[model samples]
Target: MTEDRKKGNSSKWRPQTMMVRGGLTRSEHGETSEALFLNSGFVYDSPEEQSARMAGDKPGYIYSRYANPTVRMFEERLAQIEGAEDCRATASGMAAIHTMLVAPIKPGDRIIAQRQLFSSCLWILKNLMPKMGVEVTWLDGSDLGQWEDATRKPCRFALIETPSNPLLDAVDIRAVADLVHNAGGELIVDNVFASPILQRPIELGADWVVYSTTKHMDGQGRTLGGAILGKTSKIVDELQQYYRHTGPSMSPFNAWVVLKGLETMDLRVRRMSDNARVIADRLATNPKIKAVRYPGRSDHPHHNTHASQMPEGGGSMLAFSLKGGGDAAFAMLNRLGLIDISNNLGDAKSLITHPATTTHRTLTEHERAAIGLDDTWVRLSVGLEDPEDVAEDVEQALAGR
Candidate 1:
């Protein structure tokens, strides 16, 4: 470790402090901000140095596809905040998910996953994994009994997304982790919805944690990035080979952008959660709304589990079903003059999406119904806007119903 790393590790700085200063390595110039090394290749002092680096005898970046200084800085900073031994940054959220799922397992391995997940993730499990000769079993994430029953037969891995996409369903991470462990399987938690500011899955018994840094980390909706955090052995030893060869590496520029965004992640996530809570509460009272789901709210189906696992807040996302179904949902979205219609979440600007038609469109009607995602459901990603103003905009949109 360098002197800067030693200092950062020795000091017991809090999350906010670490976000600003953790894993920061200065160039010889001593610049105030993290330097972006945009070069695709690095120069070596001699052929001996290049041979040593290639042979793993020396420590230096050989190629951008394998590693880069700016990307390393972002990875280290994220690992510090996440309390992980190491981390790897990816090109996008889906890339991170694909890497985590495909790296450790082989043909005939069994993987269990929560049925309620982002459509892309669902496709990987239900469609892609099988082609690779991997068997997948989908179960209700909120049900501890189902998780236990499913894990009775040992599986290679298990995956789940807490505060599930569009629906905001919370899963019991600790219990599920314990079950998966006893079954001799690793647990991977997709924590994009919860954000690192509110949830740390590694501390809750998850063997690995994944995030779409594109979301809350880059709260400005600027860059697309993803991260995987776990033991150094798992990341550097096991996953690095696949990552290096497959080339899903994050760009140096995107890494730098996300590094800057991490500085304000803690503040922005909390503010957005606060705004989401206000909007969810207001929407619950509207007669045109049939149902509302926000983990921060006490009435949520798994509110107790959410409280125990995610004590920080409900997160910046929420979902509700309109009484009039798809047409009314589109009408309400069209009527909104403030909130933009978008499929992306965790932005500085509030975004709303109709999941049945957009994010989860690939699923058949029966599959959609099985997950309780109907035409009326609308997913909202609350932003850093004033809570009252966001509430008013949502309320006025409902008036059009």
Candidate 2:
């Protein structure tokens, strides 16, 4: 802004302002919108310069596999909004998440993670990582006691999701971060559900914060991308090797799409979050719903921690159980007209999903029970619709349409 330019530092700009303008790299023509560098390679000005750039003695793009102007703009803008020292984009949200867990890990290194995570994340921790000769342990993230107990032993990495997927469970980030740090481990937070507009894990002492930019960062559901942000070498320098070699780089085109998404993310998330608050209240009073968990409500078991941890109130995600069980949940989802029944969340359109049958299906009945996910439970990602309309559709569905 003209005022900000006079103030002399972009860092002083607020979150919404940063999201729109932070990572801009104007081309020679200085287009009003960001330019998409769609090519996979850049031409060298000279062989000497190419050799210098290739050898890392200079700063310029060598290959699109690791770096692109459009992707870098998205990374920088998000980093500024999130207050992260640096950021890197990836192919998908899961790519960012899986990479965050595996990037700093190796054989024989132990990792501790919360049990309530997206199924893909669970696979990495419970299935894939163990097969790689790494020891993995799971804990109830809401239980600080469980966190402390698990981190008391020396471990290389600790992973958790605040307001975890579908369930909305929250934990004290600072308390867990200190414990992990004391044990010579790093705390990596997946702050996907609670977008940077609502939470900044880095400010809460997290060593690294990761995002599935596919979700709220690209609030319109236009693209798939992921990012890892931190102020440490582990993310800036070390993780670069893993990202470069694994070929999980994000598309420069998707990055540009997300750049447009970021410009309006502040408005979209806040509106959706507001809609969620209203829908949660309506669901709580419904006779057909057995239980409701929303971070903004005082009745939520972890509402206090959520309030302390997230500067904004509860986000757009909420979970509820039907008094009529899975059949009723499925029927209700089938009846909805305005809301979509999909595995995806964080979209301009409202979405509903039965966690047991979809996102967590890989977990056995026994494993699902262990995590408090049951057949009747449904997860809702509130959207940019009228709150009354969303609530009415849910009510009519619960009432058998």
Candidate 3:
């Protein structure tokens, strides 16, 4: 079955079927769902076999850190969906990003990244990587010219996120991939905001993709996990050593949860994205809204690029700011009886957060201004709720007594 799948000869099976049944390795019990293996290490039948496995002369799981049956199923299933040859699950999303960047580059390496990213991700580039003697540069991702200009000097890596967090802004993946590749750099995309259901960065020319499975993949917010997917050689050869030694492995239980989450991810993401589109439209026409940004809208800065990149409607996240100010925004958040105030996204429950105060709060006020995160700005993660209820909550919240 694995051989057939790798060759793309699976008889045109739909994505939903692949999600449910792909990468199954049943034991003697013949379980319908994938079974969990909770042991720290696998035993070899003979001492010689163990030695061969240790020397990379055999094929099988050795230690949980390097590989586990449960984690392998999740990684293979994710790789299948993303159309990548290999994948590795990490302890968290930042670990995946850090491992991928740090494994390949040495001292004096340079990385060019988009200015807008999750605050922790920004810290990795601006603060963490620089401490290791790597040079990091930030550019406006929406402008292809800026990307081109930045890469002209040659860099080791280029990273970006599309329909970026909090802002819902976009960077053209394929175009930037070309720019990075022409300069001999690897392109890595953080595809957390647009889950695999809504986007496939690999097909669009990304050399690798990363996900915070804790977000949309788990869908219910049950567990914390992350994954890195890319070409097989990169994973097994380059990243495998770094991953095994550093020990940021995903737990078997979390992998099992991620596998189950994959089954319903498509349905949840579609409905939530639809609700988000409706909410974005309704809020755009209101008198209290200074600006509304949803990639699904025709007026969005990158509507044309989005049309070419994402044929589906804009994803399940959007951001808006009140014309009145932070006080008004707080009143709206306070009035919310339906949407929960939280930092997490892509949960079963609708969530909203003031990025300036919560997610991006660590950045200075001037830095927040640079990224369009103001006290008045609120990022909404639309969930599997009736569109009317979500919109009504926003409507009432905007009106102050």
Candidate 4:
């Protein structure tokens, strides 16, 4: 451990140092593990102290809905890793995204975003906000022309998801951020696909970064949580305000789970990403696969862009199309004995899912087609299993094909 860690000076600690030691508060019992404060409320010495707590004169937590010790530890530790000034943990990924995206723009404000995003995020920008009178101009992220055309005027927020779900479409954050900045908009990035270990969007010029902590942060598929992180007053003025009053707080138990999860996130993400790079390479050469979309692969269209953004490796998720289309895809998915068929990604167990049915099913056929998503596509989240074991299972699934 570094001297910064020894001193508990979070600002001076490195990412790995921050992950292991940041935000740790020990009880009088001197337990090494973070104490889980499971109560709904806190007690004070006197009415004056209670009033002070409620008045924000005191720095302690009043209600679990607004904050909790365990959850704050989780937030502080993540903020340290992510290089953010503040972080707010929420009930789930959707809550983090919704709070970050919805809080800034009122009915008359506008949003410019890519068409390629997690289905639920798309719903917020495409379906939910439109009814409330917010205008969202969807664009193709890969094409700088669309971004240029859309950001010619001012908008409240410009959003992108790098190494986008299922497809792994990596967009240029700095490039888009420059354009958005010129137009006076804050850039919001969904950093879940490329966890903080792989990419820090705030450093890439994103004003706000969001995550489904249930994914890589939890690492074990054991809990539901989300976080929104930012380095500016905007986090306090806009996002935190929405977070506090709306009561989408993360549970202390879940926070404790993720706190433990964070201790090893650096290890798990790197291992899973390594496993994925190997598996993506193995699957790419298979004649049964029509195409492969892993950032580690040289042929991936976004390889260069993704490489710049995610310095560690191509992340653990990959998507490939079956040569025989949907039927062959289903056969391969069903035949895989080791990998489970599930929509969730970023778990310790390798998971495969048909996005056209499970994740992106909400997208209209036209929408899916526009993003080049077809029935043949299957998304894979490589896990921490032995590479050979995982590869053998995948190859066996493709044997007859």
TM-score of each: 0.98, 0.96, 0.96, 0.97
Q: Candidate 2 at 78: error in angstroms? A: 0.7
Tens-digit lDDT track of model 1 for 1-401: 46755435434778899999887888888788899999899999999999999989989999999999999989989999999999999999999999999988799899999989999999889888999999998899998889989999989999999989979888899999999999999999999999888888999999999999899998999899999999998887779999999999999999999999999999999889888888889989999899999999999998999888889899999999999889999999999988889999999999999999999999999999888989999999999888788878878888974
Error of 2 at 300 (Å): 0.8
RMSD per model, one decimal: 1.5, 1.9, 2.0, 1.8
Compare candidates 1 and 3 on TM-score and give the better one: 1
lDDT of 3 by residue, 302-333 (tens): 78877778788688899998998898888899
Show where candidate 4 strays beyond 4 Å: 1-7
Q: Which segments of candidate 2 are over 4 A away from where they belong?
A: 1-9
Best by lDDT: 1
Give a tens-digit lDDT track for model 4, residues 143-195: 89999999998998988888898799988999999999999998999989889
Whole-model lDDT values for every prediction: 0.91, 0.87, 0.87, 0.88
Greater-lDDT candidate between 1 and 2: 1
Clash count, one per candidate: 0, 0, 0, 0
Write the candidate numbers in order of decreasing TM-score: 1, 4, 2, 3
Residue 385 lDDT (model 3) = 88
Q: State how far residue 12 of model 2 sits from its true place (Å).
A: 2.3
Give the CA lDDT, 0 to 100, for residue 40 in model 2. 98
Model 3 lDDT, full chain set? 0.87
